[model samples]
Target: MLIYANRDAVEAWSREEAPDNVDVLIRRASAMVGVATRMARYEVTPAGLPADDDQADAMRDAVCAQVTVWDKAGIDPTAVETEGRVSKTSMDGASFEYDRAAELSERTRVASTLCEESYDLLRLAGLIGGRPWQR
Candidate 1:
């Protein structure tokens, strides 16, 4: 599947390399696109509709937000494991620690959430009707 948001757009929004794992990111973004479109009360075209500028930006930001999620994990989010030590381990008697993923930045969290809300991002970005959202 073709990603609506290009690498440049993702880089501009994220300032990081787009994931080399294109298929995984594309799959995630595709699902979100449906959710976003639905929240906008818009039906997706059977052949796929081109996004307007604001919608494209939102899509770019949203995809980069997901890439950030993987980046924070210090492992390819889409990779499969064959064999490895567990992320958590116990010592001698009872001491143990677990690795924790980094927290997502506020901007990424908000951008992803906005896209998920569909109507919010679409309306706020004026990709939908060029009018303020009804209270």
Candidate 2:
């Protein structure tokens, strides 16, 4: 239940007033971030946010970006319905087919819940993967 983004933070990141379900969005987004960054260990604040200011802000922005994408997609994050990119298309029949979600379980999570902006935010924050160099 670690919520990385609040109403005010989400609103500021999105540059728009948050919706009534902002808490719900934050919960879902935070869960997605946890899953996405399970490999990276970060020092957290007393409130459970990243200790590094930049990383913490990036996390908030990433969560907010995810919320914005979910809000735009109109998909209920709490629901079990499958929604995402089209998997199949037919040129002749003019048919389109969407991919059904793979089996879902608490531990069998997927990255489809994350949006592009969120991914980029985490990447830039050095949370997803670090940039190593030698001088």
Candidate 3:
């Protein structure tokens, strides 16, 4: 249910077509989890109860996996600066200065931890459905 727009195509489309594709993409990504849950046999109760643990876990895992893939594909998770002062020519640009490198490393570690946690969470969720959890 993940929709990745071609960056080049999006830019071209923005010029010729409407700019609403951005919003549409956002809406689709946001709704993917709910759609996935329903397809997975989860029914939301009227009491505002959270989704079944297993389903939630699965969703988290899927999200984490998606992030992991993007990370491995060289997308910087800490590139927040908009100023042109910092160079973006290489992967080892100023963005990875000593302090930034350490922070990025720590963040990567944390992301990996979260990925594992999501898997464990999914396992727990499966238990709620009286199904054996598989890793």
Candidate 4:
């Protein structure tokens, strides 16, 4: 008593879903790198690690690469407070970087989960009679 739909429909759906999942993953990775960058900067400002300007620049460069990936994926880079500076705000008399590390971590996890789910969906659709690759 089961009715089967067209194979093309399922294949189309899987293809449509995969890009969205990949986009989410890319965005999450970008945000995580951004937060990590801000944290590194904060640590440097307070004389925490690296203890030198050159090392800090290197860390910034790594973060910038992540930002580039986000840009390519059509995700908005974190907003800058100044033309060439990260946003910093004073809250409760304490300076807080706009980069929310905890939130970024959570988002990255969610994006990863989505990616796994999307992959499983694709596999299932293929097993359930999706289209074959043309090449």
TM-score top scorer:
2
Q: What's the lDDT for all of these models? A: 0.50, 0.74, 0.38, 0.36
lDDT of 1 by residue, 50-119 (tens): 4455565665565565555544444443342323333656677776755332333333443343233344
Estimate the TM-score of every prediction. Answer: 0.49, 0.69, 0.29, 0.25
Superior candidate under lDDT, 2 versus 3: 2
Q: What 10-residue stretch in candidate 4 is worst by lDDT?
A: 126-135
* TM-score attained by model 2: 0.69
What candidate 4 gets wrong by more than 4 Å, as runs, is 1-31, 34-43, 47-50, 76-135
Question: Is 1 or 2 the stronger prediction by lDDT?
Answer: 2
Q: List model 2 lDDT by residue over 57-90, tens digit each.
A: 8888989998887666565577644444347878
Please give the TM-score that candidate 4 achieves against the real structure.
Answer: 0.25
Candidate 4 C-alpha error for residue 25, in Å: 14
Best by lDDT: 2
Clashes counted in candidate 3 amount to 3
Candidate 4 has an lDDT of 0.36
> What is the Cα-based lDDT of residue 11 in candidate 4?
31
Candidate 2 Cα deviation (angstroms), residue 132: 20
